[model samples]
Target: MAGQKGDPVMVDERRFTSFADGETSLELHGLTFENGTDALAVYGNGVFTRDAAGRAALAAVVDVLRRAVAALDEAGPAAQALPDGDGRGDGATSVANPFG
Candidate 1:
């Protein structure tokens, strides 16, 4: 989107259209779970503009998101490994003991 220098930048909004055919795929027995995904295509017919700083900032944001996602993935297994406090595991001992 472009306009006079003094004018506010207005992004030319375009409606998104999607077409999908019925398809099915089987999942493998074991795979690391990844939660989110994005697919984007930016193209224009006649003219285009590039903003290096803006692109760099966008990349930085994506990197931050990836790290955040990795941290969440790492936390999930640890959380699952912990006992659920119903006194059902060998991981943690009960509070009533002979050491009193």
Candidate 2:
């Protein structure tokens, strides 16, 4: 939501999920705007997996996303969906989307 000069603002929000397939996760989102800017600033963070093993794997995924975001920020465009590593006969494994 946006407001003129000195107007107050409010927001309504909620999150609903279908199932829990992976480790533990939590999400937080917020909106803010610059003093003289017309565009709104949106920010969010999704922490996945509090479990020891899951945390380690999730951390690696975080690193991957960090690099992907940096590339976009520097090149003024978005990065396409790319695999983290070569799939060397892992059979069937589900891929997780941290952004969602």
Please name the candidate that would achieve the greatest lDDT relative to the true structure.
2
Cα lDDT over the full model 1: 0.31
**Candidate 2 error regions (>4 Å):** 1-49, 76-100
Kindly provide the TM-score of model 1 when superposed on the true structure, using C-alpha atoms. 0.27
Q: Relative to the true structure, how large is the alpha-carbon lDDT of every model?
A: 0.31, 0.33
Candidate 2: how many backbone clashes? 0
Clashes of 1: 0
Candidate 1, clashing residue pairs? none
The superposed Cα distance between candidate 1 and the true structure at residue 81, in angstroms, equals: 8.7
TM-score of each: 0.27, 0.26
Predicted candidate 1 versus true structure: per-residue lDDT over 2-100, tens digit per residue = 121212111134211111111211111121112222211222232212577656544533343344334334556663664455433235556877777
Report residue 97 deviation for candidate 1 (angstroms).
Answer: 57
Evaluate model 2: give its TM-score. 0.26
lDDT by residue for model 2 over 1-100, one digit each (tens)?
A: 1222222222233221111122222232221221111112223444556688667555544443343244334433322433354443234467898899
Off by over 4 Å in 1: 1-50, 79-100
